[model samples]
Target: MKEIQHRSDCPIAFSLDYLGDKWVLLILRDLIFTSKSSYGDFLNSNEKIATNILADRLKLLEANGFIKSSVSPEKKNKFIYNLTEKGIDLIPVIVELMIWGSKYDSYDVKDVVKKLGKDKEGTIRQLREKLSARINSDVPSNE
Candidate 1:
C-alpha cells in the first residue's frame, strides 16, 4: 500500500509530517519536563507506549536530529537518550500543549505551572544549553 502524503504548505503540516504523531509529542513532553533520559522511564510512562512503536519513534527521532542516545553510566545495558538543540527548542510547543491540556484535557499539572512561573524564558534557555551541549548529530561516538 502506498503511504498517504500531506500536501499542505503550512509549516505545522511540515512539522507534523515528521513529528505529528501522538506518541512523539508526549515522549518529547516527558523528556523536557521530567528530565527523563532512559528507556525504562519512557516505557514506564502512563501513556504506555508500545515497545515496537517506541523503538520506531526513537529511531526516527534520532535520524531527524531531534534526540541522541548514549550508554547509561549506571547501566551498561541501557541507553540514556537526550534531546538535541533542535529538540530542546521545542519547549514552546510543549508549553502550549500543556496549557491546552490543562484547559481542555483535564489534567492538573503543577509541574508545568511551576516551571513556567519560575522564569519561563530562562527555563527554555537553560534547557537549550543542556540539549545543545551534548548533541551527537547522528555521528557515532568513539565508544
Candidate 2:
C-alpha cells in the first residue's frame, strides 16, 4: 500500500482524506447494502458514475484496505469485490449518514433508515453482526 500523507492529525481529517468524496461512500454503500461487486455493477448504479472515476475510486479503495477483490469463482474472467473488516466497520458511519440525511434532507426515509433513526445503536449492532457473518463466511478456512 502506498503511504498517504494526512493534512492534519485530527481523526476526521485522516478519514476524510480517503473518504471525503461522495463517490467513495456510495461505492461502499453498494457493497454494504446491495449485491454489487463487479465494475459493471457499479457503473450501472443510479448515480451513473463515470467510467474513469469509478475505476479510480475502486483502485483507491482496494489500495487503502477498505476493500479486496478476487476473481469470481463461477466466472474466471470476472472480479468480485468484498469489504474488509475495516470497511465493514464503517457501517455505523454510513448508518449515521443515512439518519442525518433523512432528518435534514428531503430524502425519503427507507425501511432501513427508519430503523436506524428509531434505534441507532441497535440498528448499527444488527447491521454489523449481519455484515460480519457474511464476510467471515466468505473467507476460506485454512483448515
In order of appearance, the predictions have TM-scores of 0.80, 0.87
The ten-residue window of minimal lDDT in model 1 covers 134-143
- Model 1 residue 98 lDDT? 70
Tell me the RMSD of model 1 versus the true structure.
Answer: 3.6
**What is the Cα-based lDDT of residue 141 in candidate 1?**
41
- State candidate 1's TM-score: 0.80
lDDT digits (tens) for residues 84-127 of candidate 1: 77788787888877766766666666775667767878777776
Evaluated at residue 52, the lDDT of candidate 1 is: 87
State the lDDT at 40 in candidate 1. 77
| Cα TM-score of candidate 2 | 0.87
Worst 10 residues of 2 by lDDT: 134-143
Maximum-TM-score candidate: 2
User: Against the true structure, whose lDDT is highest?
Assistant: 2
Q: How far is each candidate from the true structure, as Cα RMSD in Å?
A: 3.6, 3.0
- Candidate 2: C-alpha lDDT: 0.82
